[model samples]
Target: MTRAMGRLLDDAAEGGRITPDEALLLYTDAPLHALGQAADVVRRRRYPDNIATYIIDRNINYTNVCVTACKFCAFYRAPGHKEGWTHSDEEILRRCGEAVELGATQIMLQGGHSPELGIEWYERIFAAIKASYPQLTLHSLGASEVVHIGRTSNLDHATVIARLHAAGLDSFAGAGAEILVERPRTAIAPLKEKGEVWLDVMATAHGLGVESTATFMMGTGETNAERIEHLRMIRDVQDRTGGFRSFIPWTYQPENNHLKGRTQATSLEYLRMVAVARLFFDNVNHLQGSWLTTGKDIGQLTLHYGADDLGSVMLEENVVSSAGARHRSNRTELIELIRGAGRIPAQRDTLYRHLAVHRDPAEDPVDDRVHSHVSSTALNLVPVAAAG
Candidate 1:
């Protein structure tokens, strides 16, 4: 690393902020350890408790029928495809019941952009889930979904967000933000909303008091400069609204998708992005590493590279799985992974509150039902309420 880059990292490590240009310089040239070291410093400074958090939640893809055929995704089927399916509200509630029985505190309600399903469809689902499981946090949808729902319902993004929030939606999942840069997005998810439109929707959500996490799907042949530019865009929005709860960066899966086995980010590149994001997104508080997209080992290493949270013990994940992600973890093993990484293990709510902390492994709650794909409506024919 150059002397100037070392100085920048040092300043950032010591809680001093760096500009996006400076962040790019460090991201491109600084030694990997140096970048990680600075990010760890920032993480320690931000969270002094030395806790690494994870959430127990299920990704309930309400339907696979979509009109926006993103090339990088393998999960969606065309609206009229013979295989397309949408779950009934009763089935969705039953799935939520299974999740809650298995100790889930959050429900990620995501699906495709079906032209027939508008804001009312979502409102009905959200209302049902909230009515049945009032304790479960509804961290659902993303900016792209909002845009689709708005267009279909002849309403604006703000109106969509307002109705969803009033109907018990808690926050957005920040999905469909493949990359905030325009070129790659057009090249891949051409039918999706533009990068600016996605950000604008999130800003509107923040204005309406609905916070959301921001995410990036890297390694789809995006330039490193573009990666930094993505961070810059999120940072700028965060500076004004502070609505982004966390910044999650994951690699694009290639198998079973239109992108094919084209290109993807390496583990080192993922770590570097994690560190750079921690340094660049000073306004954003949490940095979550994707063990679901990457492997569990890489997820463990991210705690040292500035990730404060190791995403979810995803009870059911179909999007990335449809692409190529095969890694899975249960509650016990996830806690062990976090503890083995030298950080205390904690189960967090959607808002990052410590719902349960496993400070001592001996006292770790034994929930056999919390295994990977343990309780779901996606994988088995087991009755939803009787599955667990």
Candidate 2:
């Protein structure tokens, strides 16, 4: 490791946070292998041989009719458009039932910003879900949704988060945070909430005793400085509230989106960010590798770079599918991947509770008949039965 890289790891080990300049050095100057080594050291220090964790969850996009018109999102259709859709509560519950049957303990309730659905709409839906499947954890929405509800209802951020929490909204998914820099955020999602407002809402949520994860959308033509700036912003809030549980940074999927194929960040850049985030965000507890966007090999590689969590099996997804991300893996395949990376595989709940840990690498399942299917959305692909 370089002198600066060694110092950076030592700072994190000594409970001293690295400066933004140090973060930039790690992002730009540190050798890839050295960076991964430092990050793995940090991970081992935090979670020793505990196996990279994954959650079994389903992303239930309740609707796709959005008014925000984010330039990079292809999932939303304009209000009143014939193709726009909103799932009935029954349809949503059925999907939840499917997830529950599949041993999913978490449900991600997310969708576009529909003016028709107010705070009361969410309250009713959450109440219904909780009343029916009281065991399922609802890890839904994000700072942007909080901002939207507050603005739409003319209530403060605290009121919106408080009311939602009371209605059984468990935690924020840290979505809607494309890049926290004002320029890139405005360029991609101009009509949505401001960068500061996103953080403000999260802080409010944290203060209300509602913990959440913080996220950044990488590879959006942002400077390395801006990327570090995003981490700095989250770290500042974490210093105050101590409510962020994890930080996840994923590359932007460029295909079939409005931005029309802007330069995407390479795997090297993504891994560097992963390592830098681990080195910089000393307070945040977990770092997740987004295999869904980066593919399985890169996902396995990320375990060495301070990512102790592999995100989720997804069960179902639509947002990235709309943008042309096609990576898919089953539970057995995921376990093998983790084992192949020389780590044990553990199934975790939304709150990082270990439900089951597979220790014997020999127990990995082999399913040779598995085949990938192309879903209607770019991110929703699944398997189809063979023709008789």
Candidate 3:
């Protein structure tokens, strides 16, 4: 590394923040390991506890009937397709029960944007789930979904968010934030909400006391500057509201998606993104390694690079898996992965509160149900009516 780059890394390690331009330069020019070392230093200093955390949650995909069909998604079927499916309230409640039985503390209710489904649809389901399983935090949906609901229901963003929050929605997930830069974001998800609009939704949500994580979907032929620009946008918002709890950057899955297998983020590229995000975001507290999309080896390496969390066991996940993500692990394996990385394993809740910290190997708890991979039996299970 050059003297200037080394100084930049050192400055970052010493708790100094770098400007977006400087970050872009380092993100593009800095050597991978050098950047990672500095990022790891920053992480160690910030999280002195040496506890790497993971969450036990289920991504309850309620339906796959989508209108904003992005190029990179292989999961959603367009509206009115013969193969579309929407789980009845009973089915959804059943899955919630399953997740709670397996010790899941969070539920991520993901689905496609159906015009027929307005805010009342979400309100009904979210209220039902909360009534049944008040222990489960509903960290589901994204800004785009908020926008879709607003348009469909003829409500403003704040009103829609207020209604959802009143119902049972706990927080927003950073879905549909592929590449927040206009050029690439429009290229991939042209029909989805704009990049700035995504942040606006978050800002409004944060204003109302609801917080969220900012997710990055890298390696879709975006320029390095655009990648850094995405982080810059999120950071600017973080500076204002301090509402973002974590920043998760994952690669684009290609196998079963519409973009085909043409583009992908290499393991090294993913690690570098993790390190850069750690260095750039001074305000965001957590950085999650995407074991679900990037594989466990790289995910484990992220603990050393700068990530404090290993994301979820995802009692069920269909979005990325539908697109070719093949990694899987149970709760036991996740704990071992953290311990193997020389950090204590702590299971966290939706709000990042530690539920259980495994400080001793002899005391590690094991469960058979906390595994990944949910097939698409319902994707083609036959079209069900949209949620009311």
Candidate 4:
């Protein structure tokens, strides 16, 4: 490391925060390896233990029909279109049952912004899920959904959050926050809520004692300054509300999407953003790496770059898969990757509670059922043709 870079790291480690200018230099000027090293130092200071964590959860996308025609989204189908569909309550509950059977402690109930589903629709569904599986945490929705609910129900953001909380909405998955910059946000997700509106909804939820995490989508043609600006926005909000539990950054997958693979972020850029996120978001407590988007190798490399969480061994994922991300890994594979990175792996619940720690790698549970399945099987499935 250069003398200036060493000084910056020393100051960051000694209780001093890096300025936005320094962060810009790190993002644009610093070498990739040096950035990773600095971020690793920050990670050690925050979490000294050698153990990294993973969550056991499933993403249950309720519907793909949406009114908002976000350019970057490959998951949503236009409302009333032939491809549009919503899961029945029974089907949703059955999936929840499967997740619980697979030892999942959390269900991320996410979907598109359907105009037909009103606030009452969410209340009833959430209530039914809670009634049946009271132990399962409903870590679902994002600010965009909340904003839609508020508009649909003719209530304020706080009212929507409170009602959802009453209906067993435990937390948010921090979806819909692609870039948090107005230009790129408008460019990609024009019909969705604005960047500040998303933050406002989160702030309102925090005020009502409903803590949630924040997310950023990198490689959407956003500049490095804009990425740091995104973190600064979240950090400023965390400074006041302190409701953000973690900050997760993932790369944008652009396949089978409306953008038509216009631009995609590289693996190195993804790691740089992750490292910069840890260095910049000093107030945030946790940093999660997205293996689903970045793949296993980059995922392991992230552990040394300020990431303490390996995201989730997703029992199922639809959003990214719909967007052409096919990377998949089972529980044993994830554990091995973490171990290879020289960190102990622990399974965690939705609330970050350690359920079980795998100290002996030899004893890791083996499972080989990890693969991407179509989001809509009934409509999209094709029967195999037997050849004579």
Candidate 5:
């Protein structure tokens, strides 16, 4: 690394923010460990507690029937594909019961952009879940889905979000934001909404007092400049409204996907993204490492590379898992992963409040039943009859 670059990272580590150009340079020119060290230093300064956190949550993919056929995704089936199925209310409630039984504090309903499933469909499902599990956080939906709902229901983005919020939508999950830059976004998810639309929807939601995280899907043949551009887009929006709770960067799962695994982000690339995102997103609070996609070792390594959160135990993750994410962990293993990274493990809620800190390994909770991808009917793709 050049002395200038070293000084730049030093400034960032010492709490000085860097511009987008400087971040891109640091992300490109800096050595892996150099960036990791500087990023970890910044992380340590912010989180002096030396605690790396993980959440015990479930991603309940409400449906897999989508219209926008993003080439990189293997999970979405067309509107009327026989394999496409929507879970019945009883089935969804049963999964919620399982998540609660296994101690999941957050439940994310990751549905598809089915034209049939409009605003009323979402409201009914969310209301039913909230009615049954008022204590569980309804951290479901994303900006792209919000846009789809508005189009389907002929309502504005704000109206769609407000109604969903009233129906027990706790927070927006930053899904479907593969690469916010137009070039990569268009190349990868052409049918989805544009990057500006995603940003505007999130900004609107923030105005309405709803917050969300920002996720960037990496390794879809995007150039380094485009990657930095993606972060810049998010950071600009975040500066206006501090609605994004965290920034998560995960690699695309290439297997069983339409993109054909022709382009993939290596583990080193993923780590660089984690470090760069932490340094760049000074306004954002948390940075999450994608354990489910990059595997447990890289996930653990990310704790030292500027990631304060190891993402969720992911009691069930169908969308990514179907594409190639195979990593699974229960509460016990997740705590171990955090502790292995030389930090105390804390089970956090959706808002990132510490629910339980496993300071003592001897006292760690043992719950093996909370396996990820555990028995979701969609997990095996043997779709049940679609919900009416």
Candidate 6:
């Protein structure tokens, strides 16, 4: 690391705030541990209690039929493919019921941009879910989905979000933001919402008091400068509205996708981005490590670096799994992983509120059924009692 970069890292670590250029330089030049150490300092300052949070949520991909067939996604099918499917309201409600039974506080209702589905489709589903599980947070969709739904329904994105929020949608999942830069986004997911449009929709949501998270899917042949630019764009918007609750940067899964494992971000690269995000997104409150896409070990290591959240104890996750993310964990193992990393584990709601904290291992809640990769929709066919 250069002397100048070292000083920049120190400044960022000490809460002095580094510019985007400084962050890019630190990401490229600083030693891994040093960068992580600086980020850890910032994290400890932000979350003084040394607690890492995880959410118990089920990602309900309501449909696989999509109009915006992004090249990087293996989860979405064509609009009329035989494999295409959309979950009925009854099916979705059942999944939500199962998730609630297993202690889930959030439901991430994601799907493709089917031309057949309009704003009314989402509004109906959101209303039904809200009426059924009033306590469960309906945190689903992203800017891209909003654009598709609005265009399909001939409504504006703002109206789409407002009606959904009125019907029960709490916030967005920050999915579909493969990269905020234009060139890479055009290359990989040209059919999806543009980078600026994504930010604009999120900004409008924030204006309406609906907070959402921001995300980055790295390793798609983007320049280091572009990565920093992505952060800069999010930071600029956040400076104006303060809507983004957290920033999650995850690696791109190359398997089973059009990218075909041609290019990918290394584990070291992932951690470097994590540290850099911690340094750059100073205004964003929480930084989550994607253990589901990356390995569990790297996820734990992120806690040491700068991440205060380990993402979800995903009661059910299928999109990344469809694209070849195999790592899975339940509540029991997740608590152990957090404790093993020398931090207290707490179950958080969609709003980042501490729903339950496992400070004492002896007092940890025992629910083996809270395991990941277990289908939230299949709990009925295989009873939890019998399955456990």
Clashes of each: 0, 2, 0, 0, 0, 0
Model 4, span 225-276: residue lDDT tens: 8888898888889999999999999888776667776788888988988888
Q: In terms of TM-score, which candidate is strongest?
A: 5
Model 6 residue 269 CA deviation in Å: 0.3
TM-score pick, better of 2 and 5: 5
Q: Candidate 5: lDDT of 104?
A: 85
In model 2, the Cα lDDT at residue 64 comes to 85
Check candidate 6 and list the clashing pairs.
none
What's the CA error at residue 103 for candidate 1, in Å? Answer: 0.5
Candidate 1 stretches with Cα past 4 Å from truth are 375-388
Candidate 3: worst 10 consecutive residues by lDDT? Answer: 379-388
lDDT of 3 by residue, 243-359 (tens): 999999999987655677577788998898899999999899999998988889899999989999999988888877777776788889999999999999999998889999999
lDDT of each: 0.88, 0.83, 0.88, 0.83, 0.88, 0.87
Q: Which lDDT tens digits does candidate 5 get at residues 1-388?
A: 7788878888988888889898888888898899999999989999999999988889898888889888887778887797788888899999999888888899999888998888999999999999999999998999999999999999999999999999999999998788999988999888899999999999999999999999999999999999999999999999999999999999998766667789999999899989988898899999999888999999999999999998887888887777777677776787888898899999899999999988888898886786677765435554222222
Higher-lDDT candidate among 2 and 5?
5
Candidate 4 scores a C-alpha RMSD against the true structure in Å of: 4.1
The collision pairs in model 4 are none
Cα lDDT for residue 330, candidate 4:
72
Least accurate 10 contiguous residues by lDDT in model 4: 379-388
**What TM-score would every model get versus the actual structure?**
0.96, 0.93, 0.96, 0.94, 0.97, 0.96
Q: Give the TM-score of candidate 5.
A: 0.97
Clashing pairs in 3: none
The C-alpha local distance difference test score for the whole of candidate 4 amounts to 0.83
Name the candidate, 1 or 2, with the larger TM-score value: 1
lDDT value, residue 250 of candidate 3: 92
